[model samples]
Target: MVRLRVLFASCWCFVAAASFSQGDTSLIRAAVLEQWVRALSHDSMQGRMSGSSGAQKAALWIATAFRQIKLKPLSPKKSMILPATVETGRLRVRINNVVGVIPGTDPSAPAVYFTAHYDHVGVGSAFSESFPKFAPFHKKTDKDSIFNGANDNASGIAGLLSLARYFFSAPRLPNTLVFAAFDGEEFDNLGSSAYVGQQEPGKVKLVLNLEMLGRARMDSSLGHFPIVTYSRDDKWVIDSLNKYYRIAFGDTSRTKYFLPDPYPERQLYERSDNYIFALEGIPANGIMMTNDQDLYYHHPADEWQTLDYGLMELVLRRIALTVYQWLKASGGS
Candidate 1:
């Protein structure tokens, strides 16, 4: 009996050590976040507006990141491009959703998907000259000028890429993983709508959408938490996550964050690409830092310099770890 007790004690110690190591792995440094944000928000990308050359360049960058991570292509053509189109009032333009997949350990296992819209509000309307408040940032009296949506979404794209890198390097994923950088999300979520329309909706078990994570800030009351929004049907999923994860925000137990408030529902959930998937009855949601009340939202002031890189890193790491744990617990394969 004494020998058996000693054996059990040793095993317990090993388990404790392993748990510590796993927590430690959740660290994402500010340096990495800075590099990614800089690249995506660079002026050369011309703000990554939909139907623009900059948007296409951003897509290429995303595809390259997938290749570097060694994720397999999901398309039958073994390519990252999922052909799509967008209608901009009078003009219809063709775009592609950059897609890649990490095959499941068990071929029959259900799939978990990750998505981020790589498009943003392009230059403002020509009426900007009449409304000084709506004037373009980089220039004066310019119509259809660049919005350079650095924090609006470039940050989210970086989070997706970082998460992809983590999963690929660890090579520990059990369930099939699908990573998509969608186009035309800025124009009424057309990209995600297209994706959901094309796929067998029932096959997707969960979706983690990244949006505006770069500018995460600690609210006076909430501490350092990232804003995580989900469909009403995903209450169980959110509860499970809140139970396991340590987030930047304080008092996460407060129902105000997850439940309906006096605020408009569409203002909170309807603006993102995840809404499209959720509408299709898939468990889909998005992570972002903006309270939707941030002063810099969609403004020229929303530049890389204004972002909190350290906080953003923490937010991204938490998201990646949450995804890892979810996949593990769900028997991802």
Candidate 2:
């Protein structure tokens, strides 16, 4: 553990970046994404099950990163830790959501959120129902019990932190940026369910939840170009962003850079924390790169080592740039 902390400290140096002049994506470089994902999905984290020691550790780590990035806490407790309860039928467990704010000059500024749940199916037996839909892929004969969840959500959390850091360094926009590392997203969106009922109902402009972006999309023919989930009304948003992305990045390929959710039958959008916010009648959506096509979706093999850090870096940069552009334009066409 001591050695792990030491390595993490060294990796964190790249986080601050020796120079901020390069670009917005500098802090979110592939190496930095690897470091964040590695630390979050390390065996030492014990799969980050909600209410477990690992989850607590992860929460503290996120709050620390937010603090280091100078993001203000949303809580009056003078901390970034926001508490919630996860209800599992008969049992209730207390968990926490780590939230931070990059305030706009106006107190009335609409809030734009970047979120990802940080919990997984913890240490479970080979037969554990951690992933029921994909249970057929489980290797019951295998001895691995830890559900590292590298892509299931460690990647999302890494993306979350990276965006927070990027916005912290960028010039202020019309909206306040809120980065939330939610807990208990597994076990049926327990954390998100509790959070959507906050003080102000409609103060939200958009919630871009990052989930499972460390790999290529196996569910769609659209390839691995990053994608978002939204209903029919918001399809134009994706198309508009695609046009902007090509012109802004000089992407000549006709391949669409953004696509809508591919697995409506599997309820991919509802499975993520973003859905609960949408239930409250807010403009909330999620960005993801893979679905059930991921062979290791919930398997023990879903470790940090299996992830493509390069792909993840691209995912982060594209989504960060798009979201930032949206914020700057004040949710325009």
Best by lDDT: 2
Candidate 1 has what TM-score? Answer: 0.80
Tens-place lDDT digits, model 1, residues 131-219: 24334433531443556677778887777777776666544555688888999876678888887777654577788788787665455
Residues 249-305 of candidate 2 have per-residue lDDT tens digits of 668998677878766787787778888887877777778887866788877789988
RMSD to true structure for each model, in Å:
5.7, 8.6
What are the lDDT scores of the predictions, listed in order?
0.69, 0.77
Q: TM-score of every model?
A: 0.80, 0.84
How far residue 184's Cα lies from its native spot in candidate 1, in Å, is: 0.3
Clashing residue pairs in candidate 1 are 123-145, 175-332, 175-333, 222-250, 224-248, 224-249, 225-248, 225-249
Lowest-sum lDDT 10-residue window in model 1:
255-264
